[model samples]
Target: MGNCIQKTNRVVLGFDHSSGNVSQKFSRGQKKDNNYEKGNLAEWQKQKGFGNVKKTMNPPQTPSVSGCLENSHPKSHPLPTPNPISNTCHRGHKKQPSFLPLPKPEAPPSKHEESSSIGTLQPAEPSLSLYSSSFSCILPMPMSESEILSSPYLKAFSLDELRKATANFCENSLLGEGGFGCVYKGWLDVETLTAARPGSGMPVAIKKLIHSGFQGHNEWLSEVNYLGRLRHQNLVKLFGYCLDGEDRILVYEFMPGGSLEKHLFKRNSPSLSWARRIKVAVGAARGLCFLHESKSPVIYRDFKTSNILLDTEFNAKLSDFGLAKAGPTTEAQTHVTTRVMGTEGYCDPRYLTTGKLSVKCDVYSFGVVLLELLTGRRAIDETKCEEEKNLVNWVRLHVLDNGKVFRIMDTKLEGQYCKKSAYVAANIALRCVNHEQKYRPPMTYILEILENLPSNKNLNIY
Candidate 1:
């Protein structure tokens, strides 16, 4: 390993860091203007080529949460009684009758037995199966709008409060925009949880939904349902939500360091050091591990660099739960069939080809993110040559060769990381991106490996 590091260092020193230009440079995946102009949803769908599938893709009416939509004022409306038989999909699709529902597992023996500290470095007991009946007590049932909004962890913010906090959503307050809507930097009073004067209150990221966008009220509710109930150190904190009339919005704790994507791929931004990179990887792994280990596991369908937000200390938190889905409930169930929705390049090929979603699909995407951290490259870089455009393919071609493994290391790292540690990290990433979904290790195992990597000094290169 010593000799290999020496040889690789010389070659790395001569490698050009500024050869290819990043072609697509958006803060988020794709940016849309925050124009609030009303447009016809049918025409918009037609222009986007969704006319052919309009029948199957029509948004299902959400009677459970429609009561809040009727009130335009900020005053608290009476909580509407939930529908007795509301088992509709989180996305606006009606539940199909073709699939039979599985029997619910009996409650766990004790709540204390199932609980574990998420912040700890130790892995869970290996004897406990992830899908065993003991863990079924945590499976989340379909939540009603009243139950979702009434979560003690989440506050119900009125539209008027958000408007005042964001200075009426002025251009200067704009943070960033994506397919769902625009996020603006806003201020809120700490103790009272009310709108505060700019520069005088705690900062927050307010996401206002776009009515015309493909994503709408359903996605908003999905986010509220998940983030409002789930709380973890590595998960982004949802301050509250607004559902006045057709206006839909979510308020989140502001991340000072912004996204990992900006630091890793954006030009002029400071490069993340080797130690900071490892820290970020571990933080993100912990977040994913927490989700997987939940009594009712959750599959974060969309796990990408842009969705990993960092705080002032660079602690990573998973954001954007709109596309999140609940994992299989019973031990007999291996996967859940759902619509394929995730970013390209980072998406699992098996999930993309067969709409069977599982926790391992997230592991595959995590591998892509690990590759990005290792090589300082985008998962899909259109600017690069044909062979190098896909990061995973390029890695497979080069990483297996012990002599060439260092060549894929981010040039900005300046050969500062441990050579053996780098080799171990690379192998971990390869195992994650394995073509066979079952071959992928669970997030717990992955987190254990990452947790040990930063301090381990005796690892062999091979």
Candidate 2:
């Protein structure tokens, strides 16, 4: 009888005399030969209590097999049955006894269960999503569609808040009426909105957009764009704006004393004193100087008393910018040609005839204002005698002669004003009104001249 044995590192397989093959795993293919000899496999089976082990010719259709072999803290076979083979001699099974079954594993806790046991979780350690949420909280809320369209500075106001501040556009809140809009006296809710008076705790003038029927859109944009960016003591500040449907409005810091025109024309009360008049004229001159000599020169196209507004202290600030134009060139002599636009007596004759506007145009208007200040007389009075009426012609005829200068001085001044300073001012006014625009001194020189004039009002009269 013959016996076959195959040895591996930790396992051994043997074939009996009756089997043709011996292996640790089962296969579907049938064995080609059956050995005729009976060998030591019988002796191995008997000693292991595996009696008369024999090979099967035909394998089962579905073989019970394991993908991998493992161990329970030690070496273990992949056989499904705990003790499938009692002896190795029959079909290459191991000689030792199989191990015991493994114990079942414990299940893990769920999210809800874990939370309940541990306590509330710290907000899912802020991820990118959390950062986005935080940013949303800190960022300003978006304005409505109407506000976005109408207000150039949309960040300044909301519709509902402005409505409340203006008492829902009440008529009693009205302050001054004009072509572009009406100015209203109203208490702003500054506590919540930055557009309101900073910390004054009082009312402000709100210049709401009126139904002018004209193309005021450009004017609205101009005011917000320029005034929104400019901050100075001599410039009127634009506080905020509202864009609620068809109603577009702008708010400005109120000027209690109103415009210079009201005082000059005596629309409200008696004319201003000579001292006050000189102060106002100089203040207005300084305002124009700032506009003309700024880093980028700004020419006041509509330079007149009406465009000058007076604050609580009677301090003058340039108010209207709708017609203000930037200088054409860097040279002080640069002139720009445009359609004639300005009040009659105040308009520069050269600018009107040649259609060429320049800083000199502003200079000419200032000359007229200076005349108003010195004589307390209207630039052109139709009611006065022909020779005495037009202020420019009157000044031209009288300024060179000293005695005629005194007669032209405001009677209200009563010879109680500074004659030397008044003469200096009149000479400056003459230069400003000179027929040749080139002969006029620059505003800086004019400012220097005015500054050097003594401000002592108590000096003895001429």
| Top candidate, metric TM-score | 1
Model 1 agreement with the true structure over 12-87: per-residue lDDT tens digits: 1111113332222111011231221233445544444334445445442322221112122122122222232322
Q: What's the lDDT of the predicted structure labeled candidate 2?
A: 0.57
TM-score of each: 0.70, 0.61
- lDDT tens digits, residue span 1-462, model 2: 222111111112222323433323210122212222233444433443434557542222222122112222111112232222321222333322222122211223356542332222232232323211111111111244343344332245666666666676678777777666677776654444443433345566777777652326665665665554444456676666766677767777678888887887775477676667776776677667666655456677676777788876787777866666657656655877654555667777666555677898898888888887787787767779987677877775554322256777877666767766776677667667665676565665555455545555645575
Given candidate 1, what's the lDDT at residue 221?
85
List the pairs of residues colliding in candidate 2. 17-37
What TM-score would you give candidate 1 relative to the actual structure? Answer: 0.70
Clash number for each model: 1, 1
Q: Candidate 1: which pairs clash?
A: 138-296
